[model samples]
Target: MDEHESGAAASGASGRLARYVVAATLVRSADGGAVVAIVLLAHASGQPDWASGLLGASITAPHLLGPFIARRLDTARDGRKIIAASALIHGTFLGVAGLMLPVTWAVVPALLLILSGMFGPMLTGGVSSRLPSIVGRSQKSQRRAQSWDVASYGISGTLGPAAVAWIAATSSPLVATLALATAAIAGAGAVLALPRQSPLHDPGTVPSPAHTLGSIWRFGPLRRTLGLTVIVAFSVAVLPIYAVAVAPSLGDAALAGTLVAGYGVGSLTGSAVLMAWPLRGDSDKLTSVLAAVVAAALLLVIATPNFTTALLAFGAAGIANSLFFAATLAARSEYAPLETRGQVFIWVGALKIAAGSAGTAVAGTLISGASWLPVAIVAALSAAAATVCLIQRSKGRT
Candidate 1:
């Protein structure tokens, strides 16, 4: 390629990455806030605490099929459009739920949320799996992009809950729900401005779901990456618990949202630090170390004497979680075969989301026992999973 062509290509990639980051944050913030908005709405409506978690679960549980849906996108001419459409559809459900939650049966909104969640992949893995094509083939460029992408989740995580909580505190839960839902529509518009692209398949060369799963199982390091992904995500479900059980008992209910936002703020801080001085190592190995760090930080939260200390602990854990996420993403990409790569991202991401849902359900039940019980169990499980991943790494799995 000519020097001119290389320059133009780099410029284009830079531009695309910028737009992708902005749009992703908008979409993710809406999706992330859905948990808080729904929980608060349910609680405000006088539903049981378990019902609040179940409602969040309703939207997230459908993430199980994301990997297969990813294959469908792999065959599509342009996935961004589909992803944008998904955001719009999901936002619509949240909006409708907001409007109807006051007068309609809770079941009606629950059903809407379930359908909305079926499209959840677009929010997480769908856009992420496309980073390679967007950022070009350079490993450095891709790593940088991954940090930026993870940072979006961090920003969204902090913004989503804080936004909803502020609005709920000042206005009402219904208004917060509607406001958050608009992010999806805005994200759809941002996605359409990007360049057109071909499908991942060559018309008829798509792999089967079984083939994709086989690839993941065959790679020891990749399998470990996925396992740690689940454990981290499950522990992260403490978001709702902070809102419903822990923070409120300590003080105001708004503190629950504030605590959740602290984690996100920590995520943002960690990702920023990584981006400035990017890590260089076996990503698979990095993942295990980061996972252990995350678990340790969570345990620290349990020992904090008060809300201020708990927030700091949560932020520390958030930073660790963001770093772990980047390592896992890199490991999965490096270890998985190219053909099934898209499926791998969505599949792993689906499990991550599903695990979080399971955590919410379990946390709700355990909240009645002791507020610290859920955090304790989650931290222990994450620590165990991190150790297992490290052992596999030592076995020369990478």
Candidate 2:
């Protein structure tokens, strides 16, 4: 290629990356804000705790049918347009919910909340499935893009809650809810600004859902990676317990918050570092190695008597968490059938949510009987088992 053409290509790639980052950040930030806002709004309106749970359910319940929604996107001529439209509608519903929650009948607000949540699967699944197309097919480029995507989640997770708390405290929870609703609409505008692209597949020949799902089951690598992902998700469910566990040991309770926050900071830092130093060898191997390292860290958290030692270990585990996600995502992109790519992404996401829920439940039971150490031990053992399975599977594949 000519030097001028190469320069133009680089510029275009950078521009696209910037645009995608902005759009992703907006959507994720809104998600973070909405979670806190929903609960706060329910409480401020004199609704019961169950009402807050209902609000959360309205959002998460959509993931059960996420694969179908993702399938619809794969078959659409312009998934980007679908994403923009959904974001707009979602924002409208949230706006109505915000308005109704403060004054109108509770039923109306509840319905509006449910309606708003119906579009979440489309927004998240569409964005993730489209990353390959947006970033191009190069492995190194894909790794960087996926890392950035994970980093975006961490950033939004941090900022979103803070924004909600600040806004609700200074203003009103309803105002905070409405503000996040506006952020959703802004996210739609950002989606609209994304460069146009061809559909994921020919709409005429888009694989049936059954075929796509069957294909996922048949692909050994995809199957195992997904299984491992669920295990990882389950293992991380008790991460919040770490803060409680660390407080007594440290003699300074505030150190517990710092230790917990270190995980996110480490994840963000790891995303950047992994972007530059891409993992070598098989992606599954990378995943297994990461899982093992994370397992070791969790064990340290369980065994360490010193606060500093446990804190550093927690940070290392956090970095592994991010790296494992990047590796697994890259593996999915590489191995998933083109016709079923969207389904795979949606399925993985749903599975992670379910697995995390299960993990949390199990940890709660264990912690009630004993303490945080038992929960950490359970999580670590689960991860170690997954690592062993991956290593054995890799060996068999060889």
Candidate 3:
């Protein structure tokens, strides 16, 4: 082909890749928004603290199941089909459950928890596995893909709560749930548009799911990456509860909402900053220090008695979280084998879910006793653990 024709073809391919990346990102954004809406709906329905706990549990409990399911399904006849099917089923079920049941019904919360948990790994693993296919195998390409995913989530985190507030105010909280369901449907559509099987997975070679996951665990780099993810999750767990704690003190629910919005704003800023100028360094060292910084920020929130200080602290925490997420994912992808990328990614998702659940549950119980010190202590410990893990990994590498 002539030079012009070749250039035109290359440009066309780039455009297609960009579209896929954008679509994947939008899907994730909608999912994040939907999750926030579900939590808000549970609260609005006057579910007791136990019920709310269950709602949170339900959303996260899926992480435990993620590794097992991804292991089995990753070797299935069609990984993409499995992902698309899961998304469609999750969306439909969630929508119907939200529409039919009142907030007080225990069944609704249970169903939401189950659906969300099941959907979490399927969606996350599917997306991460597919990334290498849409973008090239180069580090730069992978970083771009990861950045797109993080950026979408950052935007969703900001908009999701606002959308929930607006919908909950004007109409029923069910409206918000329905909106999330719509996003799930769109996400499924995006998955369907993808090639039948991810190029990351070889059609000719099938490894035992157990072996696949086991290999990921054996890889020092992946293990360190997962360890950092756990710490990130623990630090993040503080944000939701912190927002709730600060709400009553502000004398307005809207202020609490604004606090979260501020965090979202900071998250967006952080992600943008990362994308504009990505981090390049020793992944283990970089992630450990970032986790420590985030932990320190959380401590500031706990130490400060004033609402203004708390707000600033929370905003800074959000920015730290955004950077940590981008950096962590980039590190994970780099260390993972392409064939088993989905399994590794799912494992990270599972670790994060477990950590967040544990952190939130513990933090909630502690804060109930009117003490924020315990919250800070837990965050500090988690960050410390993450740092130690990374340091050890660095040492081993040397």
Best by lDDT: 1
lDDT of 2 by residue, 227-313 (tens): 788888788767766566557767887787788777777788787887678765677667666766667666766666777777777
Q: Scored by CA lDDT, what does every candidate get?
A: 0.81, 0.74, 0.69
Instruction: Locate the minimum summed-lDDT window of 10 residues in model 2.
Output: 367-376
User: For model 1, how does the per-residue alpha-carbon lDDT over 119-237 read when each residue is reduced to its tens digit?
Assistant: 77778877777677677666788788889888887788778888999999999988899998898888889877766655655735767767777778777887888888988889878
Q: Look at candidate 1 and tell me the lDDT of residue 258.
A: 79
Give the clashing pairs for model 1: none
Model 2 residue 230 CA deviation in Å: 1.2
Taking the tens digit of each residue's C-alpha lDDT, what string does model 3 give over 85-183? 767766777677666546347776577558666766676655766666666666765676676667766765556556767887899778987886777
Candidate order by lDDT, decreasing, is 1, 2, 3
What's each prediction's TM-score? 0.86, 0.91, 0.84
Model 3 collision count = 0
